[model samples]
Target: MSPSHLLALRPPPDIEAQVVAFREAHGVRDAAAVPHVTVKARSGLDDHLCWLALVPAVAAATPPVPVELIAPRVFPNGSALHLPARSPGAVQLHLDLLDALRPTRRFGYEGPHMTPHLTLALGRRDVNLDALLDAARLAFPQPLTFTATDLVWMRKPGPGGAYQPVEGWTLGSTPDP
Candidate 1:
Protein backbone atom coordinates (compact mmCIF):
# COMPACT_ATOMS: atom_id res chain seq x y z
CA MET A 1 0.00 0.00 0.00
CA SER A 2 1.04 3.60 -0.50
CA PRO A 3 2.54 5.32 2.52
CA SER A 4 1.10 8.46 4.02
CA HIS A 5 3.39 11.45 3.90
CA LEU A 6 3.63 15.19 4.49
CA LEU A 7 5.92 18.10 3.78
CA ALA A 8 6.78 20.33 6.71
CA LEU A 9 9.15 22.95 8.09
CA ARG A 10 10.50 21.98 11.50
CA PRO A 11 10.87 24.52 14.28
CA PRO A 12 14.27 25.58 15.58
CA PRO A 13 15.71 23.89 18.66
CA ASP A 14 14.61 26.30 21.40
CA ILE A 15 11.05 26.66 20.16
CA GLU A 16 10.82 22.92 19.64
CA ALA A 17 11.88 22.36 23.23
CA GLN A 18 9.10 24.63 24.44
CA VAL A 19 6.53 22.78 22.37
CA VAL A 20 7.68 19.44 23.78
CA ALA A 21 7.52 20.78 27.31
CA PHE A 22 4.00 22.05 26.77
CA ARG A 23 2.87 18.73 25.35
CA GLU A 24 4.39 16.85 28.25
CA ALA A 25 2.82 19.15 30.85
CA HIS A 26 -0.58 18.65 29.26
CA GLY A 27 -0.28 14.84 28.76
CA VAL A 28 -0.54 14.89 25.02
CA ARG A 29 0.50 12.02 22.81
CA ASP A 30 2.97 12.04 19.91
CA ALA A 31 5.37 14.30 21.77
CA ALA A 32 8.25 12.65 19.96
CA ALA A 33 7.04 13.88 16.59
CA VAL A 34 9.00 16.93 15.51
CA PRO A 35 7.26 20.26 15.95
CA HIS A 36 6.60 21.70 12.52
CA VAL A 37 4.55 23.94 10.31
CA THR A 38 2.99 21.70 7.73
CA VAL A 39 3.09 22.70 4.11
CA LYS A 40 1.17 19.78 2.62
CA ALA A 41 -0.22 16.82 4.51
CA ARG A 42 -1.01 13.15 3.76
CA SER A 43 -0.59 13.14 0.02
CA GLY A 44 -1.82 10.41 -2.38
CA LEU A 45 1.60 9.61 -3.75
CA ASP A 46 2.56 6.08 -2.74
CA ASP A 47 6.31 5.85 -2.89
CA HIS A 48 9.65 7.59 -2.68
CA LEU A 49 9.84 7.90 -6.46
CA CYS A 50 7.14 10.55 -6.45
CA TRP A 51 8.78 12.27 -3.51
CA LEU A 52 12.04 12.06 -5.39
CA ALA A 53 10.46 13.91 -8.26
CA LEU A 54 8.69 16.48 -6.12
CA VAL A 55 11.49 17.39 -3.70
CA PRO A 56 13.87 18.61 -6.37
CA ALA A 57 11.15 20.69 -7.95
CA VAL A 58 10.31 22.26 -4.62
CA ALA A 59 13.97 22.97 -3.82
CA ALA A 60 14.64 24.47 -7.26
CA ALA A 61 11.74 26.86 -7.00
CA THR A 62 11.93 27.78 -3.33
CA PRO A 63 14.17 30.29 -1.58
CA PRO A 64 14.76 30.39 2.15
CA VAL A 65 11.54 31.77 3.62
CA PRO A 66 11.51 33.91 6.75
CA VAL A 67 8.97 32.67 9.28
CA GLU A 68 7.60 34.64 12.23
CA LEU A 69 5.31 33.22 14.87
CA ILE A 70 2.53 35.62 15.76
CA ALA A 71 0.17 35.28 18.70
CA PRO A 72 -1.77 32.15 19.49
CA ARG A 73 -5.13 31.58 17.85
CA VAL A 74 -7.76 28.88 18.27
CA PHE A 75 -9.16 26.94 15.39
CA PRO A 76 -12.62 28.13 14.45
CA ASN A 77 -14.24 24.97 15.76
CA GLY A 78 -12.12 25.05 18.96
CA SER A 79 -10.47 21.74 18.14
CA ALA A 80 -6.90 22.99 18.50
CA LEU A 81 -4.70 25.86 19.64
CA HIS A 82 -1.99 27.13 17.33
CA LEU A 83 0.61 29.80 16.79
CA PRO A 84 -0.09 31.56 13.53
CA ALA A 85 2.92 31.93 11.29
CA ARG A 86 3.45 34.80 8.84
CA SER A 87 5.78 34.86 5.90
CA PRO A 88 5.14 35.79 2.30
CA GLY A 89 7.92 33.51 1.16
CA ALA A 90 6.51 30.56 3.10
CA VAL A 91 3.10 31.12 1.55
CA GLN A 92 4.64 31.24 -1.88
CA LEU A 93 6.54 28.04 -1.09
CA HIS A 94 3.30 26.33 -0.17
CA LEU A 95 1.70 27.41 -3.41
CA ASP A 96 4.66 26.18 -5.40
CA LEU A 97 4.67 22.80 -3.66
CA LEU A 98 0.94 22.50 -4.24
CA ASP A 99 1.48 23.15 -7.90
CA ALA A 100 4.22 20.54 -8.12
CA LEU A 101 2.07 17.93 -6.42
CA ARG A 102 -1.22 18.96 -8.04
CA PRO A 103 -1.50 15.72 -9.93
CA THR A 104 -1.78 13.76 -6.69
CA ARG A 105 -4.68 15.97 -5.62
CA ARG A 106 -3.73 15.23 -2.02
CA PHE A 107 -4.19 18.62 -0.43
CA GLY A 108 -6.15 18.00 2.79
CA TYR A 109 -7.62 21.36 3.72
CA GLU A 110 -10.32 22.98 1.66
CA GLY A 111 -9.50 26.49 0.47
CA PRO A 112 -7.87 28.85 -1.88
CA HIS A 113 -6.29 30.25 1.27
CA MET A 114 -3.86 28.50 3.59
CA THR A 115 -3.57 29.60 7.22
CA PRO A 116 -0.15 28.41 8.27
CA HIS A 117 0.08 27.52 11.95
CA LEU A 118 2.18 25.64 14.46
CA THR A 119 -0.13 23.56 16.59
CA LEU A 120 0.35 23.97 20.34
CA ALA A 121 -2.30 21.59 21.65
CA LEU A 122 -5.16 19.40 20.57
CA GLY A 123 -8.43 20.41 22.18
CA ARG A 124 -10.33 17.92 24.26
CA ARG A 125 -13.72 18.24 25.94
CA ASP A 126 -12.30 17.23 29.30
CA VAL A 127 -9.81 20.11 29.20
CA ASN A 128 -10.89 23.66 29.98
CA LEU A 129 -10.44 25.58 26.74
CA ASP A 130 -10.16 28.98 28.32
CA ALA A 131 -7.52 27.84 30.79
CA LEU A 132 -5.53 26.19 28.03
CA LEU A 133 -5.71 29.31 25.93
CA ASP A 134 -4.49 31.42 28.83
CA ALA A 135 -1.58 29.11 29.44
CA ALA A 136 -0.67 29.04 25.77
CA ARG A 137 -0.62 32.81 25.69
CA LEU A 138 1.80 32.96 28.60
CA ALA A 139 3.95 30.17 27.22
CA PHE A 140 4.38 31.87 23.87
CA PRO A 141 4.12 35.55 24.55
CA GLN A 142 6.91 36.93 22.39
CA PRO A 143 7.20 36.57 18.67
CA LEU A 144 9.77 34.09 17.40
CA THR A 145 11.38 34.32 13.97
CA PHE A 146 13.53 31.99 11.89
CA THR A 147 14.58 31.25 8.35
CA ALA A 148 12.73 28.23 6.93
CA THR A 149 15.73 26.79 5.15
CA ASP A 150 14.68 23.18 4.63
CA LEU A 151 11.68 21.07 3.69
CA VAL A 152 11.38 17.76 5.52
CA TRP A 153 9.72 14.73 3.98
CA MET A 154 7.86 12.74 6.66
CA ARG A 155 6.16 9.38 6.37
CA LYS A 156 3.88 7.12 8.38
CA PRO A 157 4.10 3.44 7.55
CA GLY A 158 0.44 2.72 8.11
CA PRO A 159 -2.77 3.94 9.64
CA GLY A 160 -2.40 5.64 13.02
CA GLY A 161 1.37 5.69 12.70
CA ALA A 162 3.82 8.27 13.95
CA TYR A 163 5.42 10.29 11.19
CA GLN A 164 9.16 9.90 10.79
CA PRO A 165 11.59 11.93 8.71
CA VAL A 166 12.41 10.20 5.45
CA GLU A 167 14.54 12.86 3.81
CA GLY A 168 15.05 16.60 3.47
CA TRP A 169 15.81 19.18 0.83
CA THR A 170 17.48 22.52 1.49
CA LEU A 171 15.80 25.55 -0.04
CA GLY A 172 17.69 27.55 -2.67
CA SER A 173 20.64 25.24 -2.37
CA THR A 174 21.91 21.97 -3.86
CA PRO A 175 19.37 19.47 -5.14
CA ASP A 176 17.65 17.02 -2.81
CA PRO A 177 20.11 14.75 -1.02
Candidate 2:
Protein backbone atom coordinates (compact mmCIF):
# COMPACT_ATOMS: atom_id res chain seq x y z
CA MET A 1 0.00 0.00 0.00
CA SER A 2 1.04 3.60 -0.45
CA PRO A 3 2.66 5.43 2.43
CA SER A 4 0.64 7.51 4.86
CA HIS A 5 1.11 10.85 6.60
CA LEU A 6 3.43 11.72 9.47
CA LEU A 7 3.00 11.51 13.27
CA ALA A 8 5.35 12.52 16.10
CA LEU A 9 5.80 10.31 19.19
CA ARG A 10 7.28 10.08 22.64
CA PRO A 11 8.48 6.52 23.08
CA PRO A 12 9.72 5.55 26.50
CA PRO A 13 12.14 2.79 27.34
CA ASP A 14 10.14 1.76 30.40
CA ILE A 15 7.03 1.35 28.30
CA GLU A 16 8.87 -1.07 26.05
CA ALA A 17 10.07 -2.96 29.09
CA GLN A 18 6.58 -2.99 30.51
CA VAL A 19 5.13 -4.45 27.33
CA VAL A 20 7.64 -7.24 27.33
CA ALA A 21 7.02 -7.80 31.00
CA PHE A 22 3.29 -7.87 30.45
CA ARG A 23 3.71 -10.33 27.62
CA GLU A 24 5.85 -12.63 29.71
CA ALA A 25 3.67 -12.17 32.74
CA HIS A 26 0.80 -13.40 30.61
CA GLY A 27 3.02 -16.19 29.24
CA VAL A 28 2.37 -15.30 25.61
CA ARG A 29 5.33 -15.82 23.26
CA ASP A 30 3.73 -15.95 19.90
CA ALA A 31 5.76 -13.73 17.61
CA ALA A 32 2.68 -13.20 15.45
CA ALA A 33 0.66 -11.97 18.40
CA VAL A 34 0.43 -8.58 20.08
CA PRO A 35 1.52 -8.22 23.69
CA HIS A 36 -1.18 -8.25 26.35
CA VAL A 37 -2.29 -5.00 28.07
CA THR A 38 -2.59 -3.07 24.82
CA VAL A 39 -5.89 -1.52 23.78
CA LYS A 40 -7.99 -2.75 20.87
CA ALA A 41 -11.32 -2.18 19.13
CA ARG A 42 -13.70 -4.33 17.13
CA SER A 43 -15.48 -1.77 14.97
CA GLY A 44 -12.58 0.75 15.16
CA LEU A 45 -10.77 2.95 17.70
CA ASP A 46 -10.86 6.51 16.35
CA ASP A 47 -13.89 7.42 18.44
CA HIS A 48 -12.14 6.49 21.65
CA LEU A 49 -10.98 9.55 23.60
CA CYS A 50 -7.36 8.53 23.08
CA TRP A 51 -7.85 8.05 19.35
CA LEU A 52 -9.78 11.15 18.40
CA ALA A 53 -6.85 12.24 16.26
CA LEU A 54 -6.39 9.16 14.05
CA VAL A 55 -9.98 8.71 12.85
CA PRO A 56 -10.25 12.24 11.62
CA ALA A 57 -6.87 12.07 9.89
CA VAL A 58 -7.87 8.89 8.12
CA ALA A 59 -11.18 10.38 7.14
CA ALA A 60 -9.44 13.39 5.71
CA ALA A 61 -6.65 11.53 3.94
CA THR A 62 -7.96 8.11 3.08
CA PRO A 63 -11.68 8.68 3.14
CA PRO A 64 -12.08 6.13 0.38
CA VAL A 65 -10.57 3.47 2.60
CA PRO A 66 -12.87 2.45 5.42
CA VAL A 67 -11.15 2.08 8.79
CA GLU A 68 -12.76 0.31 11.75
CA LEU A 69 -11.36 -0.01 15.31
CA ILE A 70 -12.32 -1.96 18.41
CA ALA A 71 -13.08 -1.12 22.03
CA PRO A 72 -10.67 1.09 24.02
CA ARG A 73 -7.91 -0.30 26.22
CA VAL A 74 -4.69 1.15 27.73
CA PHE A 75 -1.82 -0.66 26.10
CA PRO A 76 0.27 -0.06 23.03
CA ASN A 77 -1.96 -1.76 20.47
CA GLY A 78 0.95 -1.19 18.01
CA SER A 79 -1.26 1.18 16.12
CA ALA A 80 -1.58 4.75 17.44
CA LEU A 81 -5.18 4.96 18.58
CA HIS A 82 -4.91 4.08 22.26
CA LEU A 83 -1.22 4.77 22.77
CA PRO A 84 -1.52 8.19 24.43
CA ALA A 85 -0.68 10.07 21.26
CA ARG A 86 -0.36 13.45 22.94
CA SER A 87 -0.46 14.67 26.52
CA PRO A 88 -2.84 17.27 27.99
CA GLY A 89 -0.58 20.02 26.66
CA ALA A 90 0.89 18.05 23.77
CA VAL A 91 0.63 20.80 21.18
CA GLN A 92 2.72 23.17 23.19
CA LEU A 93 4.90 20.38 24.51
CA HIS A 94 5.47 19.00 21.06
CA LEU A 95 6.73 22.35 19.93
CA ASP A 96 8.84 22.57 23.04
CA LEU A 97 10.07 19.00 22.61
CA LEU A 98 11.13 19.70 19.07
CA ASP A 99 13.10 22.61 20.32
CA ALA A 100 14.39 20.58 23.24
CA LEU A 101 15.49 17.60 21.15
CA ARG A 102 16.04 19.38 17.88
CA PRO A 103 13.79 16.68 16.47
CA THR A 104 13.06 16.88 12.81
CA ARG A 105 9.63 16.27 11.38
CA ARG A 106 11.22 13.89 8.84
CA PHE A 107 7.84 14.21 7.22
CA GLY A 108 6.07 17.46 7.80
CA TYR A 109 2.91 17.29 9.90
CA GLU A 110 0.03 17.18 7.44
CA GLY A 111 -3.23 15.58 8.48
CA PRO A 112 -6.79 16.49 9.35
CA HIS A 113 -5.77 16.00 12.99
CA MET A 114 -2.76 14.75 14.96
CA THR A 115 -3.78 11.79 17.15
CA PRO A 116 -1.29 10.00 19.39
CA HIS A 117 -1.83 6.63 21.05
CA LEU A 118 -0.22 3.27 21.66
CA THR A 119 -1.52 1.37 18.69
CA LEU A 120 -2.30 -2.34 18.97
CA ALA A 121 -3.72 -3.27 15.59
CA LEU A 122 -5.22 -1.98 12.39
CA GLY A 123 -8.89 -2.35 11.44
CA ARG A 124 -10.27 -3.90 8.29
CA ARG A 125 -13.81 -4.27 7.07
CA ASP A 126 -13.53 -8.03 6.79
CA VAL A 127 -11.88 -8.55 10.18
CA ASN A 128 -13.60 -10.82 12.67
CA LEU A 129 -13.82 -8.77 15.86
CA ASP A 130 -14.95 -11.74 17.92
CA ALA A 131 -11.67 -13.47 17.21
CA LEU A 132 -9.75 -10.31 18.00
CA LEU A 133 -11.53 -10.00 21.34
CA ASP A 134 -10.74 -13.59 22.14
CA ALA A 135 -7.07 -13.01 21.39
CA ALA A 136 -6.97 -9.82 23.45
CA ARG A 137 -8.67 -11.50 26.41
CA LEU A 138 -6.08 -14.25 26.46
CA ALA A 139 -3.23 -11.75 26.28
CA PHE A 140 -4.00 -8.75 28.48
CA PRO A 141 -6.70 -9.10 31.11
CA GLN A 142 -5.33 -6.29 33.26
CA PRO A 143 -3.75 -2.89 32.86
CA LEU A 144 -0.01 -2.32 32.64
CA THR A 145 2.07 0.80 33.30
CA PHE A 146 4.45 2.68 30.98
CA THR A 147 6.19 6.06 30.84
CA ALA A 148 6.82 8.62 28.10
CA THR A 149 9.94 10.76 27.87
CA ASP A 150 10.82 11.25 24.19
CA LEU A 151 9.18 11.90 20.85
CA VAL A 152 10.01 9.90 17.70
CA TRP A 153 9.25 11.29 14.30
CA MET A 154 9.17 8.73 11.46
CA ARG A 155 9.15 8.99 7.70
CA LYS A 156 6.67 7.05 5.62
CA PRO A 157 6.55 6.71 1.83
CA GLY A 158 3.79 9.28 1.30
CA PRO A 159 2.36 12.52 2.55
CA GLY A 160 -0.52 13.75 4.76
CA GLY A 161 -2.42 11.29 7.00
CA ALA A 162 -0.76 8.07 5.99
CA TYR A 163 1.89 7.30 8.57
CA GLN A 164 1.47 7.09 12.38
CA PRO A 165 3.68 6.95 15.48
CA VAL A 166 3.67 4.36 18.25
CA GLU A 167 3.21 6.45 21.44
CA GLY A 168 2.81 10.19 21.56
CA TRP A 169 3.48 11.26 25.16
CA THR A 170 3.79 10.06 28.74
CA LEU A 171 4.58 11.11 32.37
CA GLY A 172 7.76 11.85 34.39
CA SER A 173 8.91 14.46 31.88
CA THR A 174 8.08 17.97 30.86
CA PRO A 175 4.28 17.74 30.84
CA ASP A 176 1.39 20.13 30.93
CA PRO A 177 -0.23 21.55 34.04
Q: Pick the candidate with the highest TM-score.
A: 1
Candidate 2's TM-score reads: 0.36
| Reference-based lDDT, each prediction | 0.74, 0.34
* C-alpha-based local distance difference test score of model 1: 0.74
lDDT tens digits, residues 1-177, model 2? Answer: 343222333334554454455435534333212322221211122222343333232222211111122333443343222333323334443333333323223223412233434444444344433455455555545543333333332323432232335443332333343
How do the residues 1-177 of candidate 1 rate in per-residue lDDT, one tens digit apiece? 546777778888988898889877876654235678877766544564555576676776688878998888888888777888897776777778777776446454622478777877666666565677788889889988988878888777775455777888888886735
The CA lDDT at 151 in model 1 is 86
Alpha carbon lDDT of residue 124, candidate 2?
Answer: 36
Q: What lDDT is reached at residue 10 by model 1?
A: 80
* Range of the 10 consecutive residues with the lowest summed lDDT in candidate 2: 59-68
Question: TM-scores of all models?
Answer: 0.84, 0.36
Q: Candidate 1 — number of clashing residue pairs?
A: 0
After superposition, the stretches of candidate 1 with alpha carbons farther than 4 Å from their true spots are 1-3, 47-49, 104-112, 124-129
Q: Pick the candidate with the highest lDDT.
A: 1
| Residue pairs with backbone overlap in model 1 | none
